[model samples]
Target chain A: MPNILVVEDSPTMRQLISFAMKRIPNSHVIEATDGVDALKKMSSEKVDLILADINMPVMDGLKLVSLVRGNPTYKEIPIIIITTEGAEEDRKRALSIGANSYLPKPIQTQELIRLVNSYLTKQ
Target chain B: MEKETGYLNKADEFLQMFKKGEEFTKELLKENEKLRYKIAQLEESMERSGDEARTKLYEDRIKLLEDEINSLMERFKQVEEENKDFASKYIEVEEENNNLANLYVASYQLHSTLDFSEVLRIVLEIVINLIGAEKFAILLMDDKTNELVPVASEGMAVSAAPRVKFGQGTIGIVAKEGASYFSDNLSYMKEFNPTTPIVCIPLKIKEHVIGVISIYSLLTQKSGFTNMDYELFNLLAGHAATAIFSSRLYTQSERKLTTIQSFLDILKEKPRR
Candidate 1:
């Protein structure tokens, strides 16, 4: 079972993601409100993958990426940035900051599941 | 001969006296010439002093004028800078006002369309595009069950069959309160497993709460919700409710008219028979 950390600010969005992730077999989804909360969780638990939103309060997704990458303990964790903005610049920024992948918002469930499965299986 | 000698002596005396007198007059004339020359030099010096004083006064006046001109120029520059700043700010405010006006007009036109579903779809699209929400859903109140049922949705997959109970979930809470509600993280909510930030706004028609509009990130979780997002969602909900209400009224009237016409036709045919 892959342990996944889902960080988002919206309650509806969080529910939707969690609901979609729960469809996948043998996956445990943990939730965080923002980067700060995500970081706190990361420090306490071992997460195989991280699904983060780009825009957030307290700390943003991009900053979370840098924090995760900088920590040797969590450096190898696969991180995906999901955002409403589909611009190339945002994708590039996320990638440059050590994000494993980027997904745009309003994501289809199948696509998200496939991506998470591929990453989990590959690791 | 003695008389002639005496006359000559007298003549000599007169000539000597005359010569002496002439010498004295010449000296007097020389002294007068020197005095006149000194007087002329003194007059020249006075004139020169007067001219120098006049030139100094003119220079002082010019300096004062120059200083005044410089100060005025600096003041003018300051005023110009202030004006430029004010003009730019005014333009920004005007542009914002124009955008708001355009949004209002667009919303009005969208509401005027006869199809309720289309109007709701358009409103959702507009709200999503404006606020950049990842997924959005519109749940209307079921008159019979009094539950919030998902009528239209975008960016998420909602079960069309399951009607969430009023005051059970975030959407229901919003409907129950007849107000807008926001949760940055659903995981914190006891009713819902925290997954992402959510914004839910109630749609009211003539003070009667009818439905709710909710939006959130489907794939990833946002860090937190913003006040601006809440305000924008509230505004969108208000407009959507009005449009929905109007469409419903139009449909009701249309159906009533058709029913009345059919009834009248039947009565007319019977009377003719």
Candidate 2:
């Protein structure tokens, strides 16, 4: 079973995402409210993949990326940034800071599955 | 002789007076004509100078204004061209993004029945096919223990894989912070795995941190990941988290219902007093 982490700020959005992940079999999906909470969760749990939002309080997605990439222990992990900011500059900054992939807001379920599958299969 | 001399003197005086009067009238007429001629000449000169000066000033002003207008027109044309280019590029980007979003939705609907594991497998396959990545992994967070656990992996050794602690490894950091992380050269950092280039993203739900997803390149020769890759991964992460969460809830509910049913059956089996 692949352990997946989902970080977002909205309850409704979180629920929607959790519902979508149910389609996958034997996958464990976890949730966090913000970057600070996510960091707290990371200290104890072993996670395989990360799905994150950019505009979050306590620690924005960009800052989280820099911090993660700076750590040698978790540097190899792939990070996917989900955000409402669709500007090219925002995407560039996310990638430059160490994000594995970027996705704009209002994502489609199939595209999400495709991206996740790519990472799962390669490992 | 005396009387005749006096009479002749008086005549001479009268004659002298008449000549003086004639001379005065002639002088007055000549002065008037001279004055008229001078005034006419002066007026003509003034008119010529005024016309010439006015024409010269008007032409100068017109030339200056024309130059200003031409420069403004050139600037306007340049601005128009720039606006057009910007509009075109914006449309192109919007179209590409729309296509990607559509593809994502279609894939999600196609695999709606698969479980989380299957979804992860599908995700990895799609990433490899679409992004040409050689290696990848998915790390999920445990809410109870607050740990990041590996759920799925490909193109890597499972036995030698290093476990990422919450807030410790790159995956942990992303999970904890609810953000994305990437590195071009893993070898440079002591904490990074021996991989050359790596990228990671946090799966988020309702602004919550759920898990982390990562991809890496074993060979140092491959080009590092780009912003587009991060965007795509983020999209997948969101959907993955949602599906997994719902599945877990459903399983929990099923288990509870089963337990309750067993207890009810025991009660029903009891004999009535």
Candidate 3:
């Protein structure tokens, strides 16, 4: 089973992503309210992939990317930035950083499922 | 007396013959009962064999159905995988469209105005909002001093020395050489800022480097330079320079027009000598 960590401040977005990931077999979705919560959760459990949103409270996705990439243990894990359309600047920044990829706002079902399955695939 | 004895012997022989016939009838009846039991057993064995054959047929049918279901499931999975591949391709196309849109916007904004201050403001907006640079400076070449001077800066030291003589500093080299510099490797800039990564590009017009836009430091939260930033830097080199140059000419032309109009008005007010 592939364990996915979803870090989003909005409960609605979290639920949407979780529901979407559930459709993919062998994918276990872990929900985190924000980056801070995500870091705390990641300490105890192993996460195969991370899907995070920018502009979150307490800690933002940029901070999370920096932190995750800085740590040797979790540096190799794939990170995706989920942002709205207007924040194209942040999207570029996300890629320039250590994020593996990104997802646009109003997340597409096919796109999201595709990204999840791709990263969770064994190497 | 002799005739009466012979009659008694004949009656005894007749009774013995009748007993032998009765025994033979009993033995024939027992043998017939045994044959009937054997026939019933044979019929039962045949019926059991028929049931076994029917059970085997039912099992074969079940195996066939299971194989069909397995094949259907396999086909379904293959179709799902194919759909996922298509989705990925669609996303790639969307990204290409996004890039084109960004380019169009960059071009439009660069050509939209001819005011020096507005041009500077627009360039600042593009760098900060579009390129995601938190710390940078825009230095226009001073015609008289032959040096680069900062006109607009963000997240940079406002009080820092704002002059770069030709062939003097990292940005100065760009101005002197009339070429662009874009590399994540910052070993050359060690004389200025060793630790922080930076991106610098010279603004040029008609093969002449007019000004330089350079990033000095990056916020820890901010990501490092991307190829997009290099592309933007390349854009600024041309479009931004043209806007600034045109805005300067427009200002000068307005000033000349004002001077000529005032002189004409004075001539009209004065009486003809």
Candidate 4:
């Protein structure tokens, strides 16, 4: 069983992402409000992958990426940055910081499903 | 931080401010390539494996990957609300700048002239242009009737002639008390049955209120007045009162001088006789 964590602050967006994720047969998804919440969830169990937003209160996704990459225990876990914005600088910093992938906001359903499916199949 | 998206409607060009985090596109693309490389290694391992145990391990990893995809699909739902909050906070700062600018202009133009007509014109300008009053009337205190009467007006309904008594309506209430009365929503107040909202600001000098500035409605949003609107009203209260008073005094003095000179002319007529 693979555990994936979803980090975002908006209730509406979280539901949207969850609705799209149902296309994936039978994987368990963890919902986190921010980086701190995601890290807390990670400490208790195995999170195979992470899907996070860039801008969040308490802890943003960028800082989370740096911390997760630094941690020996969770370093290899694929981290995906899901953001409402995807500027060039944002992409470079996120990738350089060790995020495995990124996705822009208002994500299309099929595209989201396809991308996640591709990453999963490859791993 | 200010919490409202109302200001975003005013500046559509700046909507991109929220999208400043766009760098994820290029970075994610590069990351995908790296993932593909890793995938090739995984495929190679699976292809090279001959032992049943090694084959089982590859299958296990592939199965795990399939499950992980489901969870990764659901990401960042409530985060946009936070972005909206940030945008609203920025807009609040912008609104403050606008308030200060309007205050400065209204104060400066109020005392810019001593002529009565010019003084009246500036009052109308401040009311209409700076304060964004939709329909307004400037009423000065009449010495004989001890009444407040309209000197100049714009956008007032012809049928809704303002004949407010000393203690009647919002206009009269402000005049009697010499205090400003503002309401964004008039219908909600107890016993406040006005046809439309009208902010009544008493124009004052020291303790004396010389007149009332009646704002019939706001041009932008008539629902209510912001703190900045009240600040403008405060400026008008003191500055406008003094300006109108001075202009009236100047006109009165000029008339007095003319009467004095004509009397002197009558007295000097003996020389011609």
Best model per TM-score: 1
lDDT of 1 by residue, B156-252 (tens): 5766324678887666777888877766464543333222226677888757888877765432334444444455566666777888878867878
Per-candidate TM-score, chain A: 0.97, 0.94, 0.94, 0.93
The reply for model 1, stretches above 4 Å from the true place, is: A1-85, A89-123, B1-29, B70-74, B158-162, B183-197, B218-234, B256-273
Model 4 scores what on Cα lDDT? 0.73
Per-residue C-alpha lDDT of model 3 across residues A39-115, encoded as one tens digit per residue: 99899899999999887899999899999999999999999887653356767889888988877654455577788
Q: State the lDDT of candidate 3 residue by residue for B1-273, as single tens digits.
A: 677778877777777777787787788788888888888998999999999999999999999999999999999999999999999987776655444444556667667778777778777767764466656788889989888888887766644535788777677888888777666564444344521226777889989888888776544334455555667677888988988888878988998999999999999989865
- Each candidate structure's TM-score, on Cα atoms with residue i matched to residue i, is 0.56, 0.41, 0.50, 0.42
With a 3 Å backbone cut-off (N, CA, C), the pairs that clash in candidate 3 are none
Q: List runs of model 2 lying over 4 Å from the truth.
A: A1-123, B1-103, B106-111, B157-160, B186-197, B218-222, B262-273
Error of 4 at B80 (Å): 19
What TM-score did chain B of candidate 1 earn?
0.73
Query: Candidate 4's residue-wise lDDT over B75-180, tens digit each?
Result: 3334566678878986676566545545665666677778887888787766654455656788777767777777887666433546566666777778889988
Q: Residue B139 CA error for candidate 4 (Å)?
A: 1.7
Please give the DockQ score of every candidate, comma-separated: 0.03, 0.02, 0.04, 0.01
Give each model's whole-structure lDDT. Answer: 0.75, 0.69, 0.76, 0.73
Considering every candidate listed, which one attains the maximal lDDT? 3
